[model samples]
Target chain A: MTPTDLRAAFIADLTAVAPDLDPAAIGDNDHMQDDLGLDSMDFLNLVSALHKRFGLPIPEADYPRLATAALAVAYLDQALAE
Target chain B: MSIFTMPSLGADMEEGKLVEWLVKPGDDVKKGDIVAVVETQKGAIEIEIFEAGQIGALLAEPGQTLPVGAPLARLGVADEAEVTDPVAAPEPAIQASRAAALPAPAPAPAAKPVAAAAPGDAVLASPAARARAAELGIALEAVTGSGPGGAVLLSDIENHVSAGPQPAAQPVAEDRPKGKPGLDMTEMRRAIAAAMSRSKREIPHYYLMHEIDLQSAHDRLTALNADRTPDRRLLMGAFLLHATVKSLAKVPELNGRYDVEPYAPSGQVHCGMAVAMRGGGLIAPAILEAQSKDPDEIMAAMRDLVARTRSGRLRNSEITRGTITISALGENGVDALIGVIYPPQVALVGFGAPRVRPMVHDGTIQPRLAVTVSLAADHRVSDGRRGALFLTEIDRLLQEPAIP
Candidate 1:
């Protein structure tokens, strides 16, 4: 898939995990915990979902970057760019 | 000469009875070889010698509970006698090998709970707690021992168990919730209170009090409770239980408890009993597989349940989830009062006021010992048609002369 497509897919997965947020509202700047009400377990589940969807290894150290929806999009964009 | 203090073993070991002496006076002693057997912590352990020397003095008396390390035996210097000691070379190597084999319990750096305890202030808790503390790999000194003389309690270990490196299930707050919002019974009860208020409020439940016609079931029950004692007896409650079991067997549909949560058909026959505790609140414990057990066995199980519930030993798994209930107030002057149908359990059968009441048998007024049986049925799953049928079956089982 194209980088943009993969990033959009990543955004779609995040929105599915956090269904309260409208798909249009989620972006790089939106934080999962504070902005989307995703707790630690939900955050871990999000990482697991991302790993399954993209087939990439996500280390615990990368948790900070994935905290925000914008950072998640960027990280997914970079991994797909690779 | 090393001043070897007694190694603090279990918390309960304030002092130990010297069980046996492995080495005699003037016997050459090795470091690892058990010099003596000290009975501490309600069990015996082989006390190893620290120094390779001559067994010069026997300080502790056998069968006397001496404080650990009260100088049971002394070792003289090698030059004092012609000591041909073969065990000396392996002692240092054995010490090193023991250190290498065992995981070193390095206490957290710069963190000590308090000053080391004196002999009088040492732990004396149960042996199990000491072994548990050891298994947690906790430093005894770091733990604020909470037993007698500041020794630790079992709860203290549990409370402090997760403070160190926890491998898994660390209450991530989001994963395993301690609790959730209480179920709001407003809407559900409004409809229930309406029906129940209407049932008691409207449907005139004609009073029909019957006595415990216990002629045939008694002989079998008497034979059952009678035997070489395991200490359980089949009383009137057991008779009631047997009757209820028989009643459920006669009417399979009556066995169902109210289950509206899943909105699926509930297919269980759990009988709930109302136990009046010393305190004010009332709780009904459900008996599963009531039909399968005989009167004696049912009474035995019921006694255990009563004892467990009264002593606060009943597990949450016991009562938190059940299929049905048989809440009774037979001793409490209640003659089959109207019972509230507890949610999810389809029926709550309350037994009450077991006494003699005059009844007309073939135009002859005769006084017969009768008991009031109240059944509260979930209206959503069943109506008065099925409810009456269920009650008739229960009445039949209680009054029947024979049950196979």
Candidate 2:
């Protein structure tokens, strides 16, 4: 998927876990925990949904790399490419 | 016919407002069928019937706040054929008579005085049926139940609607207490006060705290989820619940209710998870038979239980049947929780957020993600030594990769 598509999918996944979250308001560089108010459980659920949808395994070591939407898109794009 | 009364969901609950009925008269029902939604301090609990039979009649009106054991509906033995293969049968004359008598030319007498006089009279009605009846402004006494044993159900409400609106006898909101917002903190606080005060007063509680190293379990979880997607991932809480159940097996004295003559030990682990509501107050409902479940199943059950609990849709079994309790404060929560033992229950276990702490592993100092596990057991049933052993078992279980 394209970078834009990847970001959209991530927002959709985030919205599913946290129903109160607004997809349109989320910025590309917004930190998930700081900006989106996602706690550890919510973050784990979001990652789980993303991995299930994309057929990818988000390793614990790369969790820091995917802290923000732009970073997550970039990391996923690279992983998908290889 | 058997009168199914309002069940006591918990020791604290004295009365429940019949929120809605799922069945109408004459519908066939079985044991374990969710028949009604009763609003208690905890939330909207779906009450299940213990007896399998046909619905006879709905005695309690929707919106009626009744005490525990007050008859909600009547249940009767299902026909031999219907029990084996349930199908739509013709409505009985008594039901037809009630349906034909419209707007009750005059206010009618109480519908089930004869049934009420005898404890054995069965009335069958689902919670959905009663709720819909109240919403549509139809009198349940007027609708003929077509369910087995003349029980009223949702279809009967629809049938009444098809028959056209009858003049409502009671104002929708009259007699019933004014409808309040879903989360009423004042009422919740009162309920919590009663329960906590009772716990503190009755049970002789002995407390113990143990620090558990989660580094190995954390690394193991990460490795297990390494090849799996997020959906398939297991949280640290799942491991904790599994370990708690296993430890209880080794120290059985710390499990079960302490209210009766002799403190009874529940052979199975029905672990109560103390969840704080977003609005206010707390509820610790159980995930029945936690010991029998695997980590993945426990994770799924925990997720579903938390969701349903927060959404105010807990089942009766989840609320009433817990033998032991677990309270966990997440990453954002405190370092330790010394909780009061929820009464009837002999033990309450708590877990604080996992934080980096200086630890001596293999005689060397290193940073590890460690959490404090605390137990509050009833002194009448157990002492601190047993509590310590249980905590030790939990710590040991987390270190192993295979938790079965």
Candidate 3:
């Protein structure tokens, strides 16, 4: 998938975890947990959603790479490329 | 025949407004079936019936607020023929007939007074709608009503908020209000205040804290989840809950209710898990018969409970049947939290975030993932020694964490 598609997919999963979140309000560099207020369960759910969407095995060690929206899209894009 | 009353969802809940009836009269419903939805301070909880029967009559009308123990509906035996004559049944049956007959003519006139009342005097809105509006900081008068008799509903409030124009400027974190989105903070605060106040006033609580090394438990969980998917993976909180349940076996004194003068011990452990809602506040619902459940089962139950609690779909029994409560602050929480015992329940177990701290292991200092476990027990039921033993048992159980 293209970078734009990957970004959209990540945002869709993020919104699914936190329905009240507005896509426009989230900045690229904002931390998902610290800024967006996604708790541990919510973060797990977001990872689960991304895994389901991208069909990738995201190890727990790599959770830190997906801390921000831009970081998540970039990580997923690189993983997809691999 | 039986009457399903408006259940007290929590100790603080005295009354709940009938939101909607999921089952109509003549609908067959068995035990544990969600028959209706009631709007309480917590949120709109889907109320379930414990008896198997056919719905005979819906005694309470939608949007009507009724006190705890007030009859919401009548149920007749599933095999028995529907009784057409209202006089043949009990007193509530007659009242049910009047309720059924009055809906067509009564609502129009009855609703007028509530709608016509001075602004904010009595806004004709469901409890859920009022809560949503309050959370959004939207005045009820500004939002157009779309419900029955032009009543403002939750959907209308959501639509109003979303369709309206954005604010001229985004409020910074410091300027933003205290509450999180999607929860009725004021109502929840009031409910929490009442319950905590009552707990402090009535229950003589004794607090105890213990630090448990979670290196073994953490390693076991890691091994368990190494090949598993996110959906099936176990959380550390599940281990804490399982250990708490098992430890209750050793200290049975802490696993019951203190409702009456004489403390009664529960034969089974219905573990109450304190799940924090998305916005703010928390609810402690039980995983019934938790003694039979393993760590994986506890994890699954906790996930389901968290989802249901967030969505406000909790059952009456889940809300009321907890014998002991456990509150675990997840990885993001502080070092430890000393909790207040939920009334009637004798003990509450609290698990703070597990952090890697230096501890003496094998006669040498080593970094281990250790957690602070705190217990608040009713002094009337159990003393500090029993409470300490209970904590020690939990520490012992976690030392060699159960894999299955």
Better of 2 and 3 by DockQ: 2
Which candidate order results from sorting by TM-score in descending order? 3, 2, 1
- The positional error of residue B127 in candidate 2, measured at the CA in angstroms, is 33
Could you report the DockQ of all the candidates, in the order they appear? 0.00, 0.40, 0.24
Give candidate 1 regions above 4 Å deviation. A1-82, B1-232, B249-262
Instruction: State each model's CA lDDT, in order.
Output: 0.52, 0.76, 0.77
Q: iRMS for model 1?
A: 25.1
**lDDT order of candidates, top first:** 3, 2, 1
Q: For model 3, how does the per-residue alpha-carbon lDDT over B19-137 read when each residue is reduced to its tens digit?
A: 77777666779889998888777767878888797776566676667777666766666655443323222335434545564442111111111111122224579888887765664
Backbone clash count, each prediction separately: 20, 42, 0
Question: Which candidate achieves the best DockQ against the true structure?
Answer: 2
| Top-lDDT structure, candidate number | 3
Better of 1 and 2 by lDDT: 2
lDDT (10s digit) by residue, model 2, range B172-239: 33343221234446656778898889999998999999999899898888788776666777888889
Candidate 2 lDDT for residue B52: 87
